[model samples]
Target chain A: MSAPLVIIAVAIAVAFVLALWSRAHKRMDLEQWAVAGRGFGALFVFLLLAGEIYTTFTFLGGSGWAYGTGGPAAYILAYGAVAYVLSYFLLPPIWRYAKARNLLSQPDFFTAQFDSRLLGALVAIVGVIALVPYLQSQMTGLGLIVQMASYGRLPEAWAIAIAMLVLALYVTLSGVHGTAWTAVLKDLAILAVVVAVGILLPARVGGLHAMFTSIAHLRPGFLQLGAKGMGVPWFISTVALTGLGFYMWPHAFGAVYTAKNERVFRRNATFLPLYQLILLFVFFAGFAAILIVPGLKNSNLALLAAVEHVFPAWAVGVIGGAGVLTAMVPGSLMLMTAGTLVAENLYRPLRPNAGAGEVQTVARVVVWLVAAVTFLFSIHSNAAIVALLLMGYNFVTQFFPSVFLCVWRRAWVTLPGAACGILVGVLLVAYFALTDHTIVAGLNSGFIALAANFVVTLLVSAATRSWDMRRTALRAADIPVHRAGEYDA
Target chain B: MSIRALALIPVLCIFVGVVFANRTYPIVLGMPFLFFYMVVCIVFTSLVMAIVYACDPANRKEE
Candidate 1:
């Protein structure tokens, strides 16, 4: 076997063994499998959240955008820092509510807050639909990394298939606990690879100044936004939308639920932006690639192509291993989150009397199912990885208004209002995305949809405000809404 | 300004100012000046977040 293949093999093997060993002696119940029993400290939570944040998106998409859009790639850096600020205030209330209410998933939070299983089911469906593209994109990145790492010997299809099977096995066996342990290794490898490639490539072509000077000469205004089409309005809107949607992902909620205390999350939010600086390295790699490896049809190939060109066999293997881990770590988390949604929210609500064990069993089965389906999509789908991810974020961001209302003390939003808001938001997203319009001069379609969602939710709530008029009184009366479909108080 | 409100400074400076300013000259540390300004904003953000954490009652509570 080639060095790249051998190194990749050893990395995957180590990840699996570490994942298994994380839960070797401990018994895992549904809670353990889902949220690691909500016992992770600040460091673990930081690592886990960081792991999920800097996925194939940062490893591949950051560089890809730096190569393709140039100035617009700055949104990636801006959004995370803004999101960390948002999260400082956002996640503590969420973590408190989830911990108090024993909510395992994002859908569970919706179900409990809104007192509607159908709403939970709707959330599950929307989340899974949104996440499939994300999962598929990860698989696509993995395939590309593997194919390039093996010097074109290993087929992309087989590489993705192998990754899918391995990911499914570990997720089924170790759950979130195992994923957390592997995150440490995955993060270390990512940091090393990104630093090496980000710095080395720039240094190769007469250093950073000479490289950008050359790029400016080659494609004038490539380094600045609005030069080639990344308008200011679009950049601001995309950054803001992405910042707001950062913590809306289902897996983000799951990771939040795993925090040991509210302080863990608050502390994490404070420091998470520093972690984002790693993408600066990734952006550097792309800037370097622009000058070094020109005329690549697929911008996504920028980083890997540059790696293959610059590094030796061993370094390529290690870098490829890191790239593959980037794919698998987040890919596995997405699969686990989507599967849990399927079994716990979608299936269980239909059969309200299903046991916890049954949900766990079904969730395990659904992990494999989700991975297989996404693997198929990755092989067959024509969507770019970045586009797929942005599409997912667009769909998921509609939940923001509902969540913002739910987490706050006022329970004014009726189930019908929330549902209608989501429907309108999703439809707007579809309209803009399908029509391929810029949503009125460079604003993100999702941002527009989100605003419409908020407006509709408020209007619908005002129109039907009397429906849940006594919700506050009902809560004050300490009545459980489960006793009655309407107002238990 | 309070630390919480001060946090918005980084967001505003990076997203709004940097985009509109759009200066490309004077590449600092091998990065475009605009991009380098973003890096400065990032470091400033971290420093601000540290202050936010230190001031937060929840983070200050003795375990």
Candidate 2:
């Protein structure tokens, strides 16, 4: 067996053991399985929050964009910094609300706050649909990493199947506990691998400055956004849209439920942006690849190709092992969130008599089912990793206005209004995707959809208020009038 | 001014500053001008959030 494949195998074994070990002697319940019983402190919460930043997407897609799209790739860095800034204000109220109501899933927040099971179910459906492509992207990234690292000895399909089986095993066995524990190891490995490759690869071409200069010299416009489609307007709109949408993903939104207190989020918001600097190294690795391994057909392979060009077989094995962890940790979290959303929001509402134990069982079963479905899609899919993630973001971002209103002190939006707004936003996103018109007049179609959603929500709520007030008055009049100071108690 | 409003600094830097910084010439710290600008914005985001954390009465509350 190749050294890299052997190393990857050992890494997977160790991660699996660590994941199972996290559940040692602990009882598993619906609450424990979903949000680690809402007891994680700042450090674990930080890891979970930062988990969004360093997925297989960052390891592969971030670099791939830098290698392929050049200047537009900086949008990844810009959006993340802005997101962290927003999270400072956004997450605390959410954490407080979730804790007070014991909400375990993202849809639980909507259901409880809006007082509508139908809205909750609609959200759960949208969350799962958005998550499928994201989960598929991670699985596809894992397959590509393993195949490349194994020197083609392990086919992409087999790699995805094996990794997914391991993911399902750990997630079902230990739940969110497994995802958090494995994230610690994944963070360390990714940090070391990214820094090493970012610095070492550039040295081969006379350092970072020389690397950029050579690329710029060869391709003058390579380091800047394109003139027509991906110009300044596209960059601004994408950055704004995605920054607002970053925490809307079901996994990211549900992660707030794991925190012990609101302070965990406040602390995380402060430090997470520093962690965003790591993407610079990811971009560095991609830029170095442009100099060393130019003209790669599938630019997603840029990071791996660059590593293979310079590093020895054993080093490649180490990088591959880290890459595998990057995929598995995030993939497991996504699976866990998708399963919980299905069980709690979708299934439980339909069968209101179901017990917590039964619901937990269903969630566990759904984890395996989701893993299998995404694995199939990952193998057959050819969409870019970043593009898939963006599509997911578009769908989930539609939840922003509803979520914002739910958290406000006043109930600014009625249930019907919230429902209609999300439905309109989601439908518009679908239309944009089907028509291949993501950029409308230099603005991201998702941003445009969000604007339309906001307008519709307010207009509907205003129109419904007077009608609702009159109905309440009529119902009040129909009731028997109470005597003034009845009984004088 | 409310300390919470300081958060807008990073937002504006990223969304607005990038327009002016999108150039290959005038490399700063061995990186393209745009990339360097992003790095600066990231560091500044941490600093701004830290200041807000220090000033906010919410964080001062006892756990």
Candidate 3:
């Protein structure tokens, strides 16, 4: 067998073993299946969190940006590091609330906190919309990885279909425990294979200084934070959008609730920035690409080209396999998180008596449905790395103002305000994305929309004082839960 | 699980960067030296994670 296929087969085998070992059968139990029985210690929490952060995009796309856009790609570093810090400040109280109320999903927190299922439904709807594209991005990357690594033996369509089906099966069969356990191996595999191969590339090439001067001479503006025509406007817009939007992702917030302690959340936030070394590496890959592989029609393949060049066949196969795994685990997590919102927040509420078995059955159905629809949607996409990222970040941040106000400020807003906030936010993003009118010189859409959302929500909320959901949530936070061992560890 | 483990990712990134920064190639696949260095960083990231797991106390518990 070719090295890529062999490496993949081994990874698949490891997934199977881990699924069986982590108690796939027992995962049908609500807590065990959905949230790993809420018993992850510091280590499991760390890995699970890391697995969620690391993705195929981080591998392929980050490099693409660094290569194509040069130093501006470092915006990823600025945002990622900022996100961890924000998540730290934003996540702890969320944990205290969720553990107290036995909440599993983001919508669960909203509905329970505000006693309004409509708000829950609104967040769920936005979440499903945002997450579907994310999962598709994962599958799309997986498809590319397979086709490239196999030297086109596996076509993109067949690769995506088969890889996604396996993801669906494992998620359906094993649930959260399976995701968490498989994540450990998947993440570790990526970390190991990428590092080993990364080191070998520069040695084969002339060396670091040679790579730098070539890029500097070829495009003098590339290394400058702002190209002359572009200047600070583009960089500021990107940083502003991503900095606020990253924490608003549902899977990330779900992790907040999964933390064993407030300190764990803080530790995770503080420490998470340090894992961003790969962003720097990815940025470097782009610079290195400037020298050796001067022009490829598709810049997305920079990392793959690097692998094929620097490593032997077997090692190349392993790296290729690792890239696909990077896609799969994140794809599974996105699929699972999307499904959880549908089943727990939507279906379970409408049918309160649905048994654990019924819930499992519904979650399974939702996964396949999301996968199928997303596969269709991703068919025509050729968004640049920065563009796809900007789209995802802006779309998810629509929920933030509503979420933050409901939890923290005791300022209950009107349904009109919430509705308008989402509507205005979507319209602004759409106008910017579709019309190319987003050129405010130094401002991004998220900053504009966030400012508008806060303004509208505040005005409408002040107008309708009695619907104030904040005080009610505040009253609810003081109610204590029965303590179990390692509760808030 | 120590800060040292996390710290290694940046240290190694800088090291890989120094290597790529020192390269003489003009443009590989339409990307710059910085771009080329990114893939190397990811591999560096993966390697650090793998060794970290092997040493992790809790990984043994799971096994």
Residue A438 of model 3 has an lDDT of 48
The DockQ of each candidate is: 0.66, 0.79, 0.06
Q: Which ten residues in a row have the lowest lDDT in candidate 1 chain A?
A: A28-37
Residue-level lDDT for A38 in candidate 1: 67
Residue pairs with colliding backbones in model 2 are none
lDDT against the true structure, each candidate: 0.79, 0.81, 0.65
| Top lDDT prediction, candidate number | 2
Residue A344 of model 3 has an lDDT of: 80
The deviation in Å at residue A352 for candidate 2 is 1.8
State the lDDT of candidate 2 residue by residue for B1-63, as single tens digits: 788899898888888887798888888899888888888999998998999999989899999
What proportion of true contacts does candidate 3 retain?
A: 0.04
Off by over 4 Å in 2: A26-52, A153-155, A467-489, B61-63
Per-chain TM-score, chain A, candidate 1: 0.89
Q: Write the per-residue lDDT of candidate 2 for residues A1-489, one digit (tens) a residue.
A: 888878988888888787667667553333243345366565654544444468888889888888888888888988888888878888889988898888977888887776556788899999988888788878877888778866878777897787678778868766645545567678777877888888988888899888899999989988887643787888898888889899898878887787778887777678778878777888989988998999998788899998888898999989988988998888888888888889988888777679999999999999989888888877766777787788888899999987777676334787677888999999999999999887899888888899899888877877786765664466457545422322100
Stretches > 4 Å off in candidate 3: A24-53, A227-231, A412-415, A434-442, A466-489, B1-63
- Candidates 2 and 3: which is better by DockQ? 2
Candidate No. with top DockQ: 2
